[model samples]
Target: MNITLKPTPEIILTGDRATGPLHLGHYVGSLKQRVFLQSQHEQTILVADMQGLTDNAHNPAKVSSNILNVVADYLAVGINTEQTTICLQSQLPALAELTMYYSNLVSIARLERNPTVKAEIQSKGFERAIPAGFLTYPISQAADITAFNATLIPVGDDQLPMLEQTNEIVRKINHLANKKVLNECRPLLSNAPRLPSTDGKNKMSKTMGNTINLGASEKEISAAVKAMYTDPNHLRVQDPGQVEGNIVFTYLDAFHSDKDYVEQLKSQYRRGGLGDGTTKKILEECLQSLLGPIRNKRAEYLNDKAQLMAILKQGSQAAKEKTEKTLFDVKAVFGLNIL
Candidate 1:
């Protein structure tokens, strides 16, 4: 009798670049999912300092300095270190080797054609001066996902293309080996709406200075909420407000935790009685309440950088074992595992 064993079904891999602190955008989209998924799945969060440098190579300090900041944000958002492994990308040797090996399996044209990489290249105006590392980071990303045999990747719609590219590499590698040497991962799409920048014109981003950081102070939170874009046409309290692009209302919908109350506010505003000041005040209170504890916890974690590093070290050590095994398996398939 012959039997077949199935691969693990729900290992998770997700993380942020070490460029800056996490903001409300992170919380609403990915962090919340990480908090929930950590308990249910085998999860690993990579502080991708290496990927961060693909763009910030000139500012290496930015990446190195924020590695722990990113980890602290993970902890601040309720990702328990014991349940979810949090490791720095630069500390993982196997990921780099896997990337080098996988690069042969991906073409530069395919890399350039990736929608996410293309959009980022155009946004950064790298027109002709695109860094080799920037273009190839998707391969590194594939290495990241497959190293741990991650089967469910948490990502937004814009990131779906990257996952497609990852599976493409997995298929190519498996086909070359003529067996199921690697597991193809799937995207755990976030149902949460994308949080816009406080300016309301773009998505929330740390580089744009238009996001509310998870660790923002009370004063900063108030100022950001007050400065949020609302209906420009509704200049007076008597004028009917447009809720569609109103940043405050959008935020209220995302975080106020009371759908009925938010709907009531929207109805009142559209009927021409609600004022922006009143609306902004409601949103500010919700934000202050939401972020106050996260800010405190983040500060507490940052105070003891030694402990943060220790946590990362422990995660990286465990991650190294998984990634190294994957690397060896791949090399064995290619007949290069002689040593």
Candidate 2:
């Protein structure tokens, strides 16, 4: 509901933690939209390695191994590096410095109050021994946004509280530091909210074993598509089906080209005439059409590992310049500037 009206060519901060390869949920939920925004906004796609290390500290190799995989996933999904700055979060020192300052602006209790954090904690099953870094991630995210002076943050509705918390930190820091160093960020909500997995059990996630990777081969995607959940009530071909809760239809609505045809199919399905196999075949074809090119592109990048890292390094350097300048101004305000 809170849409940006005059949509200026402002900076945007959006990315995923490089803990694993991105999946379809990641595409529909954010990355696909980010691909379009890259042309319109001054976008920065962060591979949040620092954040990834918070929970994955014990498995540093997992974090290290997935960075390129994540980059591959981005490129595979048509995210142009020339238009969007793709930077590794752990490589940015300014972000760390900014996080240190922001930590003072927020209370421990406030971090506990963040709904996003609460949900993450429960999902991760970290009830008692929550890591300090994990608990303070919202502040670190605030630092990431403010360090880049990012005005637009593309996130899902579940992360609205995170945007609110970041703005609150911005206001608090600006007043406390006696300088308006941080800019308030607006949430560019994904048109598709949280996408459910093929299993229809929970949100599509890497850990849930229900995701179809963005770079999956056509054959692999077909196998996954065949197992996708549909209307349970419509057990047989002649049973009246429901499209409202069908994930197959949801994917079609999100990705398919022929919307009218899909709508007609849904109507027929509900009228107890259409077969589930027929509908699934349509869904499979739609998905294959979308994913085939992405798989090819990912294969190309995976073959040339050095070239991929070069692009990442180049983008990281460019992003560092912007963050360094912002960190300098923030430090100057706090009188932490050594020279």
Candidate 3:
């Protein structure tokens, strides 16, 4: 009989843009998964300042300011600092070097066809008038993933193309060098990956002024709840309501833990007796309960800026060492290590 040993756990790389404070959309989308991933794998969270600046170059200060906020949000959401390393993308020189090399392997046409990049360009109204960096960010993202040799990346449906792009680079590079230096990453898609805007217009974010932040105040939560979009046709309590397109109910479905209670509410609303006011009230309460502890934890992290900065610095150093090893291996394979 042959003896078998368990393979090492895979590395997980996931993070957020420091464009603004994270909101519930991020929580439902990736943060919660990251919190769980910490213990299960070699998880490293990147505060993607460089990535965030691909579009925010005009206002670099905004990108700089939100770095700590994103870190605080991560810690607040239960991302264990001990198990998961949190690093700043800008501090990782190896990642930038990797991006430059990876760019050579990819054609301009391939970059343009990236669905996530294309959608982002359209959403930002850039069309063809986009920055080169914005267009080549998929390569940057690939560098971010490969530097850590990450095998599992938590992403939404839109980011699947980016992951595909990363693995494309991995295959090309490894095949060319005949060495598996870069690891291919796959997406961990959440069942409910995106939360629509509070008013159901589109994304929930700072630009839209529609998101409820993880550290939102009670008053702010109240405001978001009141502003939440419900089926316009369901004005009267006795009117038959629609649950399919209601953003308030959508939020409840994501945040509320009690399945039976939520089903009861949905039944009442669909059966023509539940008022929008009542449902909104329930959602507000659910959000408040969910966000309250996160608010406290975020506050604790923010209050001690020195400690937060220290944690990030330590993690950044660890990340630098890992990326350095990868860069050294990659350079040796290609005879690019002239230094």
Candidate 4:
């Protein structure tokens, strides 16, 4: 009997959709993990232009415009370019081919059943006109993961269903070929998964217009704070404020480092003394303290557009080489390659 050795698990694949500038929600949810994981793992950050276009097909220019913004966000948030390979998703032909191959292993019914897809379609109000590409993205995501043989995928808990779908496809291909050509990926959920929108939406998203941009100016931050939803019942400053649905306290809970102060404010608000203005003021300060440096770093990266694109192209080339080998092995298994 021959003993087979397993490669040490290190390859990590994680990224952002190139639709807009990353916001405070993204920074807290996923960006923080990318920063930490890059140091320990062979990480590849793909600015997912193809994924972005799945929904924004009509506005292709939005994806292109935001690619550099995503790059700047990644670099500014401390995803070291030297350590973490940053690339554009469209540059890799192998990923597209792999997606096609993997798509054959899945069914239309199963794709329709994906909870994440269903929830997203409902959220976007795309029930009547849902795009086929948008519905089948799990197959493409599986391609991205298996093509890189990614063992670690940093994501939120809500994305667990997508990983399950990916592993199912991997198992199907491996079982049919009688060989382990693909690896199943595991999700590393962020400690702070999301920051609720100041505008009282369940999630903070660009579409919701409820986000505080990572690179937002002082005026923008102040404006967002002013617009933050507070206690509707607390009409007067002296009236008791409920913290449960109040977006101001929600943000304060997440951003304000001073827990003792936050708890004190909570007590005052509950007892009917603290005003929304005071809470907003504190939240703005906390955000300014946190986001000020990130804006500066983003500006530095944005100022040198040529260098940013060059770095991304280099990473794309490296990614292309890796995915090529994986695709070659997969094609060979299926007798699709003449070799």
Worst 10 residues of 1 by lDDT: 1-10
Across 16-109, the per-residue lDDT of candidate 4 in tens digits comes to: 8898999988887888878887777899988999999999999999999999999999888888988999999999999999999888889999
Best-first order by TM-score? 1, 3, 2, 4
User: What root-mean-square deviation over C-alphas does model 3 reach?
Assistant: 2.2
lDDT: which is higher, 2 or 4? 4
Off by over 4 Å in 3: 1-8
lDDT of 3: 0.90
User: Which is the leading candidate under lDDT?
Assistant: 1
What lDDT is reached at residue 305 by model 4? 99
Summarize candidate 2's per-residue lDDT along 1-339 as a digit string, tens digits: 897786569799998988888888888888878888888889999999999999999999888999999998898888898799888998899999889988987899999999889999999999879999999999889889888899999887888998898899889878877878779999987778677788888766666668888888788788887888888788888889899879888888888888899889989989988987898899898888888888888889988999889989998999899999989987877888887
Worst 10 residues of 2 by lDDT: 201-210
RMSD of each: 3.6, 3.2, 2.2, 4.1
Q: Whose lDDT is higher: candidate 1's or candidate 4's?
A: 1
Residue-level lDDT of model 1, residues 15-85, one tens digit each, is 99898888998899899989988887899999999999999999899989888888889999899987999
Tens digit per residue, CA lDDT, model 3, 182-214: 788888888774788888987676877799999
| TM-score against truth, every candidate | 0.96, 0.95, 0.96, 0.93
TM-score of 3: 0.96
Cα miss at 298, model 4 (Å)? Answer: 0.7
